[model samples]
Target: FIVGTITSGYYSINSYDYLHKLWLRQLIITSFHHALGFLPSYNILSSFILRWLGAHIEDNVKLAEFQQILRFPSNLLNIEHGVTTFGRASLTSFTMTKEGLCYVDEIYLGSDTNLGNGCTIMPGTTLPSKIIVGSLTLVTQKYASAQSNCVLLGIPAREMPFVIPDDTSVINDLSSLNSSSIYSLLFVCLSFFISKYLFIALYLSSPVAVALFIHAILFCAIYQYSILITKRRSHFTYSEVITHQQYFLFKLMSEFSTFIGPYLSGTQLLPFLFRMLGAQIGSDVILPDIRCITDPHLVNIGDYVRLNMGAYIQAHTFEQRILKLAPITVNHRSVLMSNTLILPGATLQGQNHILPWTLVMKDDQLPPNTKWSGVPAKQVP
Candidate 1:
């Protein structure tokens, strides 16, 4: 009995220690991810953190803010030098079958590879060097043997007969033009820590509901004040060197919006908050996710509109290294379904229904009472 008791106690202590370490690691990762969302110099900062976490990330790799690496240890992921990623690329190292089986493996990206916005790199996939992947592409393990110097596009990401350009110099130029200073990151960290502690103190002293209400009010007031002081404009060309400061300020505002979106999303407070930030939001609008609208001030939404999950309103685009800004209008009673992307200068007339996964191109205007569907959205009879 004595021997059995001693063995069980030893096992229990070991289990507890293991669980504690696991929890601490997860906490650190989550905190790091949230902090990186608002901080500038995303590529450099993220690469440093990722290397610390044991990922094999080489020099000169550009990782965009808000990208996701999921379901694998950091050591299982490998990224080579000069690889660049744009907007929210997801590298998932695990997959589950319908029958409850799971597969997990390493993911590798070769040198000078580029992944576009909203692309997915599946488990066990290996991308070759000098490969250019288009936006919204899905790269599977079958492409592991693909040749370098090719373009990949579409849902399943088939290769196109196009030669990949050596745009390393261009990427470096853009990075210099757009990178935010460390001071901005420090400011964001300070604000976040102060707000976090304030909320904790309030929660300890007051009822939950009252504490939340007061915190929300104070947060909104501070956020609005900051926005007002920035003196932002609706339209501006972003190519000139003189406008770099203004561009950085614009990025800071965007980061703030992204940081606070989850707290007010799907609530009545969201529309009010957007209005305070200069958006022309009308009555009875249902905004499930505010993150979808990158530039709220450049957006105008009419009455009784419903924007579903993943419905994106992009008010700006970059062409030939020049940033073009425009307004997006969703007329009264329009419904934007899941994953609908409305590009800059796109307008949807009254009572229009945009189906799931639709892409409304720039400057495209749809008629009233129309139902649209597909990648480049077309009217569905």
Candidate 2:
């Protein structure tokens, strides 16, 4: 009976310890996301922040360069050593089911691989060596294990039939970045921050600092507390349009992400944000401003797609009191040029290009590999 009591007590202690550590780690990561510090040398923030989150970062990985966009949420990552890549991620998921519950998990990038600009690596993925993932590639599907020696490109991320070249250029390009110059920028920003704040502290008798500190603390507390109450399981559906409940959750997350989005670029963050908000955004796709994202829960975008500046893609419209809801699917390698407007139910197929000032009508089906133009867009020969 004594042995049994001791074992039970030991297990209880272990459980408590685990939960405590998890909570602390989650708090730090969550706090970093909210800070949205996007100074010229914000990479410093990502480097230290990732280290604190138990990520194994290698020298000159340059992953920190994406700190403005990439996030390593504490509870959702377990990165290993020897990774070399230039890409960002919406990577988070532990476990999942078809009924839609996601448990956070590690998303890995194998050593000597490169995910080029506009590439999106989804959660629950493990890539192996000597691979090159092309720009705007969407990795929406889940891979249970590591894949090696392949090139994945385009919407839906199909493997190229031929073996692509290895990524030696990612390492060779470091000299062009001028790290010393970047360090100088960091120093200037740091000095200015300290000087400005120190003068305020002294001139204002420090009470202002105390009040501001208290206010910040209260803000953080309220923000975290609200998130807990609206806690959601991160998951994406393959097809079906999101329900009202999913819509509400995603919209709330969008507001939060958007508030902090401008401090840093959303190139690396928008996909995750849209997904969290019930939009089916594919891998490696680079969207323009999402401020024009109307009815995001009904939107779907394919891999390797690009949205030029001033593009407005909508999924819902109202004619008087009557409301219409439909899905917009922009397929792989498509381009929506500046000032383009895609109304509800428009499906743009592979390699389609919409010229500037084009306005696609509702339920329009754009043919593949064609260039379109005009107010009510038509094929341009």
Candidate 3:
């Protein structure tokens, strides 16, 4: 009987240890992602000095150079031994907070994953190799398992999985994929992003659009500031913030950012531009500003879909309670207008429209032919 009791105790300890490790991983990942966002603006001389002071830099994860403030919380952990370059970018990390608690560990970046301007990566993520992450994307979760060469967009990124088979490798005929092809692709992207109706249509009616823009901005600024204060006053290190319910809050915030930001971006020109400029965007969708994606390789945007201004779309959040993967989709020609938030694992079909100031829950679908508006947005006419 004693032996059995001892064995049971051992098992319990083992389970606790496992949970601890997971918590640690979560904390580490969260800290680096948050802190890196605020670091990009430091002058090279400053970055060098910081590095000389033993700053933890991750490999293949480059921070942009134009960042203004750099804040790494106390609980920062398990950073890889690699060079993180900073382009023109601003960086900021949250202070330890009661509301944002979770443990994080190592941030793994596949070779050559670049972080664009103003992009923020939250803790506990793994980015695959050779991916171009757009600017201003808020990334959270473990995406190390994502297929290489995929593109991710928005706050909570949805991976658009695409494979360039070995059979079609360019080395066999590198000349076939010449500079013109690259330019053509660039033109298509540029035209799609910069089309007159693309971002301009939303701005055509400037007054109401400006009001909505201000509303969205104020909401985000207030919320973000609150989160920052929570982090700073708590005395939690980057790693310590993810310990309890706070972890869940960050997960919620990350998911909320993903949903709200993209929904807002899906709106008309002004509001969309504001959110897109403020948040990170990945690869899949066409965003007005290229600098918004933090990890582009892990995002997927559907063809002919319009993410109107102020739309927030997210793919994944905290893995401790339940591992989740939620992606937002707008079918061909479907429009998700300003301030529309789509939660994890949502699907919207073509010709379907989500009107302004709407919030969509998880695992929900919008009928293709209808329009949805208002809080908890539902079909209207």
Stretches of candidate 2 exceeding 4 Å from the true structure: 1-34, 39-45, 64-70, 75-88, 93-96, 144-147, 166-381
For model 1, what is the error of residue 231's alpha carbon versus the real structure, in angstroms, after optimal superposition? 9.0
Question: How big is the positional error of residue 14 in model 2, measured in Å on the Cα after superposition?
Answer: 23
| Model 1: worst 10 consecutive residues (lDDT sum) | 1-10
**Model 2, C-alpha of 224: deviation from truth (Å):** 43
Question: Where does model 3 exceed 4 Å of error?
Answer: 1-43, 58-62, 65-69, 74-106, 116-119, 134-138, 163-381
- How many angstroms is residue 284 displaced in model 2 relative to the true structure, after the best TM-score fit? 30
- Which numbered prediction scores highest in TM-score against the true structure? 1
Clashes of each: 0, 14, 102
Measured by TM-score, how close is model 1 to the native structure? 0.65
Runs off by more than 4 Å, candidate 1: 1-43, 65-67, 97-101, 129-134, 143-152, 159-264, 317-324, 376-379
Give the per-residue lDDT of model 1 (tens digit) for 139-178. 8877755578787765677886665435423233334422
Model 3 whole-model lDDT (C-alpha atoms): 0.42
